[model samples]
Every structure is written in C-alpha cells, then in structure tokens.
Target: MAIMVRSWERLLLASIHDVSPRFESEVDSLRDLLSPHVGYRIAMLVVPNHWGNAPIVAGSPFASRLRDWADAGSEIFLHGFYHRDQARHQTRSARLKSRFMTGGEGEFLGLSLEEASVRIAEGRKVIEDITGRAVAGFIAPAWLYGPGALEALEEAQFALAEDHFRVWSPATRRKLASGPVITWASRTRARLASSLLAAGALRHAPLQTLRVGVHPPDVRHPLLIRSIEATFNHAARNRRAARYADLLD
Candidate 1:
C-alpha cells in the first residue's frame, strides 16, 4: 500500500529593509507593487539610531511615506538603532562596505550590556517619536546581535525580534518561525535566478510559514520586480497571508 503525504497550509509574510534616499525610487516601486497585495501583511524595517556619522534623519519625507504605509495597517519593525557598524576595530571586506548601514555599525554587536541597553532604549524612543506609534519589534543591524543584545531588547520591551531568516520572542527567547527568506541580490540576473529558484523550492516544501525579505534596490531591476510579483502571486494562489503577530497568539 502506498502512503500519501499531506501538505499544510503555509503563511506568507513579506518584509523590506535598508530604507534610504538613494533607493527612494526603488522603494516607491516596491510600495506600488505591494499596495494591491496589501492584504498579504508586509512589514518595513525603519532605522532611527546608530553610531555612524551620516546626517540622514529618520524623519525625512521618504521615511514619512513608509510610516504612512505602516499607519495604514502594514507592520513596521525597528530595523536597527543605526544600521552602521561603528566599533573602531571592526573591519568589513570591500564587498560588504557598501552594504552596511549608512551611519556605520551602531551599538548592538560589541557593546557592553550597559551600553547596548542604553542604545536600545534610545533607538526605540526615536522610532516612537517619529512614527507616533509604539514599535512592536526590533531587528538588529546585519541581523547581528551580541549575547547582550537580546537582553537589551527584553528590557526595552519589544515584543519581537526578527533576524535574517527567523522571528524570535525576546520574552521566551524562543524562535517562532524561520521560513524561506527571499532577499534582493545586487546583480539583476542573480536576483531573478534566485527568485525563480526560491519559487520552485517553495513548491516542493511542506506548506508552513514563509518569510521573504526585499531590499529597496531589488525593485529597480525589472526582472527582479517581475519575479517578486510572480512569487507573491504564486503564494497567494496556494496559501493565505499570515500575520507575524498571529503566530504568538
């Protein structure tokens, strides 16, 4: 007798990170593509505090637009206090230089517990000040957090923390989900190929929760844009959009 395997219904959640002026156009494009699919429960990461010397403020017009979207019911996560790595001794390879957040590395990864806690508190304040709403979660820069970082988040009272491919609960220090992540690639062809590959992989896996990550630059590439749209369309056909908050409850 042959046995049949049953597939579970998967939850789809899309996320975007690394917001900046240079990528405004691409961000806008992404917003447009995602607006119609708003029911999918997308999330944006906002950077408000950091150690880098960059003068860009989080309250700029571009950020305001993103905030507006969040106000309209989309989820928003505090990306990093500064998005940049500022510890003087740390060195990033050339390939990673342009990719780091603008200000330099902020105070999370290498700071002492006391220092990290202060930064986390300050960062949450900045985000709340700008958005006029309480932030539900935090995501460390580069998804890199020191051993002390998690404790800092808990003290600051953030309900959740999102890593590169996982959603964690600071309170329980347990992972809620680590789904497939679809992030942007620097090369256009590479982005499309990765998206295509990810789509196929999703089809083969037992349905669960799927999380996709997008950088603003990904939307600028026509091929990548199409691939993202196609991916979302495909997922919608197979599963319903699930909220990250819902999983905790």
Candidate 2:
C-alpha cells in the first residue's frame, strides 16, 4: 500500500457587517477583538447610509478610516444603501421570511429590479468615493434577497456577492464557495444560544471555506464575545484566513 496526503489549506473568510458611522465604536471594538485572533486583514461590509440615519461624508473621520483600511488591503463591500426593510412583500412566504429571518432589516428583500439597481449603484459610488477604489462586491443586508434584487445584482457587474449559503460572482453568477456562513446573534436569547453552539460545532466541521459574519451588536454580548474569539482562534489554528475576494483566484 502507498500513502498519500492532500496539501491544500482551507480558507477562513471573516467579515464585519453593518459598518456605518453610527456603529463606529462597536465596529472598532469588534475589529480590535478580531485582530489578534484572526489578524487584521478582514473584509468590511460598509453601509453608506444606515436606515437613512447615518451617512458617510467624503471628508469625515469615518471616511478616512475606510480609506486607511482599503490602503492596508482590506476588501470593502457595499452592504446595502439603507440597511432597513420597508418593502411590501406580495407573497405570504416572502412576508414571513422578511419578518422572521430578520427584524425588518432585509433592505433588498422586496426591492424591484430598478430600485435594487439604483440603490446598488448609489452605495457603490459612496463607498468608492470614500475609499478612492472600486468596491469589492455587494452583499445584501440579512443575506435575504428577492427576485428583483438578484436580477439587479446580476447586472451590477460586481466581482462578488454573498448570501447565507454561498459566495458567488455577480459578474458571471458562478458559485464560488458553497457553505453556511457562521455568525453570532445577540438579538434574542434563543438565537444567541443557538448561534454560540453552532459556532463551536462549525469551527471543527470539515469545510473548504469558513465564512464568519460579525455584526456590531454582537460585541455587546459577553458570551458571544467568547464564542467569537473561540471561533476565530480555532480558525486561525486550522485554516488560512483570507479575504472574500480570494475566492476569485
């Protein structure tokens, strides 16, 4: 008998979501928390205007921070125009999903194709203007999208896009990474418990790509903090932490 071994390394793709001027302190804390465990080269999913409340102006301090991250080689993504869901869903299933999957945070979940297109374009421009570079991609808030959102993304020509299950190229619409994104939830006690448990289990699961999506609200929970550190630590030990764009190559 002959012995053989596989030599490829599994990748760890980590991102901080809902990034906006409003969540600056929380984002700072999360970034600081993740750096030692996962290193600082993590993706940042930016919301140009959050719920139409906070907008990133070109010469603001937050804008400088975005530029610094881009300069330091972090991939910037247009998370959503306004990370709020107010669209009217025609179908019962769509309405239920919009409510249950996310608490009115699925901004693209009910947008028409034209509306989705306009929001994506405006968000991309806002991010690009701040970073002085092209956005790496767009990922809808709550990882939920309607038919029209998909169509708009298909036409956006972004290099990549992601949902809960997979990361794909919007340009070619090719499935790049097929895996569940591991994330924490501090929104509800039940969800928090389940998410922590899932993080523990998924950290050791045999998968090619491990995607970790951290929200600003997560930094507030101590249990979630520990679990997040544990997940990233385990990932750091076992896999190569890389950017979302790394899936392209």
The lDDT of each candidate is 0.65, 0.89
What is the number of backbone collisions in each predicted candidate, taken in the order shown? 10, 0
Q: Taking the tens digit of each residue's C-alpha lDDT, what string does model 1 give over 58-90?
A: 768856776676677667787766676655434
Q: What TM-score would candidate 1 get against the native? A: 0.76
Across residues 75-96, which tens digit of lDDT does each residue of candidate 2 receive?
Answer: 8999989999989999998999
The C-alpha local distance difference test score for the whole of candidate 2 amounts to 0.89
State the lDDT at 213 in candidate 2.
91
Model 2 steric clash pairs: none
Name the TM-score of candidate 2: 0.95
Highest-TM-score candidate: 2
